[model samples]
Target: MKRPPYLKTSIGIGVLFIILMFLQSWLEKQPEALTASSEPETQTEATAVQPSERLVEDKRVYEGHNGTNLEHVYITIFDQSAVPENDITFYDLNESYKQYSNLDSGPKLDILFQTGTAKGPSDNGFISFGTDKPNATIELRGRSSRLEAQKSYKIRLQDNGGLWYGQSVINLNKHADDRTRVRNMLAFDYFRRIPDLISLRTNFVQLHVKDLTDPSSEGKFKSYGLYTHVEQLNEEALAARGLNPDGHLYKAENFEFYRYPDQLNHQNDPNYDKKKFEQVLKINGNENHDELLQMLDDINDLSKPFDEVFDTYFQEDNYLTWLAVNILFGNYDTMSTNYYLYSPLNSKKWYFIPWDFDKALGRDAERTDGLPQWQQGIQRYWGTVLHRRYLRDPENAAALTAKIEELSAIITEKTTKELIDSYYPVVKQLALQEPDLSYLGIEASEFDPAYRKLEQVTSRYKEQYMKSLEVPMPIFLHYERKNGRDVFTWEASHDLQNDKLSYEFQLSKTPGFESLIMQIKEQPDFTYNMAALPAGRYYWRVLVHDDKGHEQIPFDYYRDNAGIVYWGVQQIVVPGGSSS
Candidate 1:
């Protein structure tokens, strides 16, 4: 119906406004709409993007379709139909090569990799058109973890390479030792949020395996249980994370940053030994290690100013953050190994990147695995030369404490509890099921309590770190039999606060000190005299107490083959001919 001209004009304006609003909403959602096929293009295409941009992109790739508690499921199939019964299979290879030294040289089995949503054991929802062929090679990964029945695996994409989460090398860890199975993922998630830190992409993976090795068995997929996928640090990883591809990257095996002139030499040097060199720092990226050797040389040279050497070789922010995070988390395993060192091709400054964090978050404490008593706070890092030297300086030590306080604000009880709340349910659900249920490190009932303990562990560790700074450094104990009597002497403890210190000498029949055979309290000297014992084993320890009533144990420890570590105790054996 024809209306007045004024009314018609108002109606037209209203209609146009509605149309524009819809267009704006659609555009906002489509900032970068990625289809399944187009996802790889975004990751593969090299662009002049900032490190922050690359970090966001990498984070998105790892988060997957469901970023919450419900993780993604990765299904791997190994068609061993043609292989003989006695021939080495994936399981056999893992068993045969448990040592880290031989793992790289071990045989890898062919695998078909696929992605799916983690529903339940009944419904994995595996994509029917997942990677068409066997696109990857699977091998055993990890040192001690390889010993478990449910071993960690390293999957390397082959010629028919399809990037699973934009990664060519995917490390699926069983977390056999970690009961929660979420500690490593928890650390990675928090580390990603911290600035100046390069965090690896981590995701919880529910794995299903179909092995055609046994012909009599049904061709149905078996639930291998839950695993955490820690992105392998490699050339591809460095590029994906927006770091220089040609940079130096090494995994610290047994490295303490000491200058191993004989082993860690130039490839052309007469004393150059690849095997021995790798026993320290395993070369992961560029083969050239000239810069690394130089850094090590400077670290070992006491004549060189420590501050200058540290400033020249390390990015202070990265170093502090790395040390601070590890300290706060009580990750004692990182004193020597369980980390990666990286530096750009042009830049002389090296950075520390965290690796293998399953042992973090008071996991050892929770399990009562007999970790050394001294493996707490600043003392945890005392074993390493670099840390001992760097922390010896009051300024550097204070800087570390400041960094710890700054990071503590971000990684608080609230943030940690949130992660635990979300992850515990998911892990517990599967952890009670078949495969994972069998290999539970802790009792099924202990899950709730264990996670509860971790909720406030960071704060507790922070207190310990602060306390460690005030206390004296651990003393080195020496024992000898002099004139039919046992003589115990230790290096004098130097309290940072310059407080008067008193010594306590203890001799125990057992390492745990259930009963003490001899005890001396408030002794001014570090030496103790006692009658020689008959043929037997004994554990002796020394403790220092400062004027402020802060006590610290000696660094000496007694570690048995059963993974029990007792600190501040030295085991002495009196031979059959020893005087009584």
Candidate 2:
């Protein structure tokens, strides 16, 4: 039978699944047999285990096979459920040990442990056993209505440190009805089904441990590694370059430099020579500065052709698709704090690379509040006010609006679903094969219900936003002649039935718009020309008023505010102009 394109792809995917299943069966069966056969001996010893004996038994030692000198000690979990005497299990470790769980109809199991240690080269010096390291501990918590229960689980080591650098998967537990068992089984199957798509990036492994000294502390007793985070240069990099602590051009050393706690102070007030650091940054590198500024200007220019590019490159519906995805995924830590920009030997252009993704996948607690304040205010503050005066004039707003609409279209349900479906097999394969990999968590299916809900809501908001953009007016011309005359023109239309369409124009040189050239009102299709203007870049826009004493609500205006409707602004260059 002839298969459709999508069907052919689906069938190919199914075949891959079969192969993975075969591989997983082979891999899991070996481990299952070993565990089952050893159960009797383990149970026999456990039966004879006394409180004092169990206390000693609770301490487990893990030694790296490689030359790496890493070691860890863990306290086993003590099952407290009211099960049969034979089914009961006990450990000397407290309940505060670490726990991990899977909530998507998969597995549930808690691993409790204490203390881990590592020495020699195997320790890699990159691993940390305390609470100071970020993501040192991984917790699996769930809110469930099926059993009317909300539970938090912890899994940790006896002693926190180990040096088996490279990738390793450790199965904490396997039981007939265990959620972790089920989840791992499914993940292994997925990986076996598509091995080619998976890759593992790290090898260090350590068990979670309870902070015996601080049991009640939040995020206490975690496992983590200490590795140098290679800084990335990207959009946030540009923001970093433009960041000024005092908001002044001088005093360049006032900027804060930080890596980890104890590396540097919150603000640099050291006795080091200010000129030395300034020379290192070379803030006066005019050519490099121009190139960086040009890149920013290009991004701004992209706003004008947004609709056309979105339609042709991203499909009309997918406008702002990438931006929306980033937001939905909780890439909210994009402010200047965690990212940096650098130039090697005065490069003409700067490039941006993503440095951190731990914040992605909506892992942070505060991320559930929906869109951030800064994003919501982009249109009002950036589009309406700042952009109007500095970035682009009102006439450019229409093009930008069209562009945003196109971007939104590109990220529509059909498109997003297609993207997810296409990547599902690959993501699942990676998750299964490299379950211990950091930064990249398991596939979409493993996410908590809250995470899924947040993603859906964010996507809907982006869609609605695209639909709400009003049509925009275009800036026609912005130029100043050598004669000290400044002229601004825009393509005008009088589609309204109201007569005597009055127009007004305003000019300002500064961003706050303190400097004014003139303010006048006339009919639609009006042009304003002024002479004796200073010779620097200027911003100007037009407004329309109805003669019938009725105010035309600024529907399409970049900033929806009363009074003076804005057309757009232009830069005027006068011959022999000087900054006043």
Model 1: per-residue Cα lDDT over 1-580, one tens digit each: 1112112247776676566667656855784532212232244424312221212224443444332344554444455544222255555666666444568777777666666555433222223334434656778888878777888888887655557666788898998878778888889888777866777777777787766554544756677888888888888777765456787889999887788776799877888888888888889988887888888889999999887888788767778889999988888789889999987676677888889888888776766656654577887776678988887766677778888989988999999988878787678888888888888866789878876887888998898787787887787899999999999999877666778888988888789999999888877777888888877888999888888988888888888668687878898988974333
How accurate locally, in lDDT, is each candidate? 0.74, 0.31
Off by over 4 Å in 1: 1-86, 97-101, 117-133, 442-445, 478-492, 502-538, 560-564, 574-580
Worst 10-residue lDDT window, candidate 2: 53-62
Candidate 1 overall lDDT versus native: 0.74
TM-score of 1: 0.79
The residue ranges of model 2 lying beyond 4 angstroms of the native Cα positions read: 1-347, 350-374, 377-447, 471-580
> Best lDDT goes to which candidate?
1
Clashes of each: 0, 59
What TM-score, over all chains together, does every model reach? 0.79, 0.28
Q: Indicate the residue-level lDDT of 473 in model 1.
A: 76
